[model samples]
Target: MAGRVGVVAVAQTKFEEKKATEHTAELMYNVTREVMGQTGLEFKEDGTGIDATLAASYDLFSGPAGAYMFLGYVVGAYRREDERVLEDGSLAVYYGAMQILSGHVDTVLLVSYNKESSVGKNLIEWVGMDQIYQRRIGLDFVSAAGLQAMRYTTKYGITPEQCAKVVVKSHRNAANNPYAMCCDNITVEDVLRSTMLCDPIRVQEAKPTPVDGACAIILASEEKARKITDKPVWITGFGSCYDHHELGYRDLADCEALTTAAQRAYKMAGITNPLKTFDLAEISEQYAYQELLWSEGLGFCGKGEGGKLIDSGKTQMGGDLPINPSGGMLSGLPVCVAGMQRVAECVVQLRGEAGDRQVPGAKKAVAHGVDGPAGQLQCVITLEN
Candidate 1:
């Protein structure tokens, strides 16, 4: 907590089915310009504006060897230090915070983009898996998520109806989010009846059609943050963990990596009880069941009790601790940028800028993100206004 870092500004593009008109860099520039405009910062290299830049993108998904090739045009990385984070965009935020904490940078611009429509989503994800073990068997995120969902439900007695509620809630919350991709009114029955892509995982239960979008945020040191904005969402705590890469070697029903990451973040933030400490949560629930599974891992409920937690209505907008007021990943945020969008939503909520989805008087929040098969890698970030 010595060199505190705060989120000064955040911006995101509207999630769309296809962004054919604009290239990747163009999409990213839209978000970067918005954040820079809000903070009145220029893209200078004399340490007068952003001191560093961090970009997140997947080479396989972006159709380029070094995906960051066009990112420099938007983040203004002409002369200043800049790096590419190949993982989830949330990692870029994490790295930016570290740069500020290291006393080397006062302001860092973080951006991430994914154009799922530009490439075969499945084929791209397929290449990321173990070619010999997983890829040959046609293991993708959907099937892996189905395996995890089945294990979690069987262990906890969570019915498909309970999982459907997650989709219903996500769609409902998305109605108030302008950036959300799918905001149509939907019910649990609708979700249950939706096309079945995988067992216990209906089309509605899984993430909506992949969208093309970008997100940008500016992180600044305590001194610079105070000057940029009066309301700065401080990064109180953060941690990440990686589980076994081989799906067979791990228990899909449990998220030990997320649990350990949350525990480390909670301890660093001095949060003894996450359920009562944070006003709300923004989680990267790529699938409906993931919300329940991850909530348990985050200590919002006991293991095997995620179903009961959802039934309690405690995570609704007006509930004790709302989750995913921005509709979360389920609303069709791009994969790589989903986690950063969660962080941006939390920042908006904490700053009282989340117009329609704002939780009343939200003072603190927690955001979660994951990567790899079955969420093998997980990251947790705690924020305070």
Candidate 2:
């Protein structure tokens, strides 16, 4: 076997409107403590001595540069000189899992949280813009997504009403999610009548921001995972890829990165037909249209057919394929932690502990993550029973 990885434990805070003003490192340390406590791995013994340690986090939402500095101190890793920190929290968790799978570390801790309540909503887009090619034109994530959605609709011939249905379903499903930021039931008509943030994209269609939350997951090798917990969610496949950064450089209607990433994941997992192989999906749907876009990108549906698939109710909780049963990003966008939560949610579903939102008889699932404007970065993971 090349390498094996599994999630051993996970913990999260209730999504709040505002973060409690705790230092970014403090929040991460608490989440880390929760994960260690649950797994009983804080005091590992290896031949009469504890082994090495690994950790990572991002500083974007921490309101400080190198927020991990404080986190390392709180976690008792400050004295060690070998600990590594990746600035991007999502990438941090990605690397944490990689370390365990590659045999570099037997145990790894992945932590990510954000105080998004304090930053401007469009901060990422503003920073992602190129000063010479894309800045000063007032372009942000909303506008970029609006452009993508507009092009998707124009190419696929989807109507705004069709898009609103996604929001309607998301809210309906989110009502049962205790950690969801938006749990209120909303109708398609309500979504269409809601405030229009961008043409063809209403306020309800876009994910509301400023969600304060923290989450972490512990990962270990296959043998270690089996010994740690009775219920271990195996990571059968993991793949990530990046598209061209410039908006005009890639196709606005579809995601090439998604297709490539999914291929790698499916190959690793030995999956032939995704719709027939996977039981549920936790995709990065920042907007309703993205669900449609990604469904096609992931081969759940063909081009210009996602709308029809949704209309047929094939993706509902009890339908042939359940998508976003955790309410997805449509219910909450906790910034850095959102992607890892997708992975954790899939693990939760596979472990049969998803509570009311669990997918019945679900054995395999997919978790998708995206970053930057125009959907520049993408990651996909496939899990199986």
Candidate 3:
């Protein structure tokens, strides 16, 4: 597919487990400033620069109402147009592309941040659930993921050892990443020995909490993209979908939302066989099992074949298709920032800039993101050189 939107510049700050020194504005500036410098672009009144600003952050995590408003000012959008999404970085970039596709803007500035240390994760997610049933039982993301894991494992014959491999691969890959947070050279036995946060979900399997980070990206129309940078990572296709909010209403073992979203994106990008179409992937897997579960939803394998896929050694470094060469969210990317960083990592790989963990001749890549208990909402973004 000939792309209409392209990402000309992308930047991200080193993610930390607890970055208490900087405020949200500082985090925004840290990345936005770098991106602007890369492109030498600004918010011009004559419509030659960034015409729209898109941010991925929520009032819950931000700790204040209209947090995006102040963030916009810090990025030189004081009185200019700005928008916000209560989703992940992939969705924000998805909307930014829409801004250009809709003829609303030729250029868009995308930003995403989450200071997880500022607030408690469980309480925040709990409040978002149904007050009468789900929240009353103290169901948060971790616990919810446990329920899903139980069903997925039991139904598909997936083992804890298979799930443990994901953590091992993620941290090992992260060891080579300069911006990732968790990069211990741990093994599968170490993961099985780690404390269990939720039944069937070990502490090591989940992303270490209280993380803080931010990312910024510049999206431009095909015409403006060529003028902004000689090399542009084109946004070939994207899609998103929402599942039933109640756990009882949906199949915990299946990622229906992700399947629909991937189908939509694949259709737009003319992808008939995902495992063959994508040279690499950067998926937001907050937990180890998600890498397996989400991969099936992405059409990399048949349903219930995630365990077999991992055992095939086809997704590791130097494999036919690598998933998350930049260490991924499992390597410490913040919630709101992971999706965009995935896209950024893909841009770097596509540009031949990924120093050590680069996939040879990577041209087409997929970046995925999701939110809510048991993966209630899902989004997929496909990119190419």
Show where candidate 1 strays beyond 4 Å: none
Which 10 consecutive positions of candidate 1 have the poorest summed lDDT? Answer: 66-75
lDDT of 1: 0.89
Give the TM-score of each candidate: 0.98, 0.93, 0.98
Compared with the true structure, the alpha-carbon lDDT of candidate 3 equals: 0.89
The TM-score measured for candidate 3 stands at 0.98
How much lDDT does each candidate structure score? Answer: 0.89, 0.76, 0.89
Candidate 3 C-alpha lDDT tens digits along 1-385: 2349999999999999888889988999989989999999988989888898888886788877776665668766667788878888899999999989988889999988889998898888888889999888888888899999999999999999999999999998998889888898899999999999898999999988978989999999999999999999999899999999899899999999999999999999899899998889999999999999999999999999998888888888988779898888788988878888999999999998888888899999999999888999999999999
For model 2, how does the per-residue alpha-carbon lDDT over 218-259 read when each residue is reduced to its tens digit? 777777888888888888887778888778898889888888
User: Clashing residue pairs in candidate 1, if any?
Assistant: none
In candidate 3, position 119 carries an lDDT of 88
lDDT of 1 by residue, 100-139 (tens): 8989889999988989998888778778888888998999
* Pairs of residues clashing in candidate 3: none
For model 3, the superposed segments whose C-alpha errors exceed 4 Å read 1-3
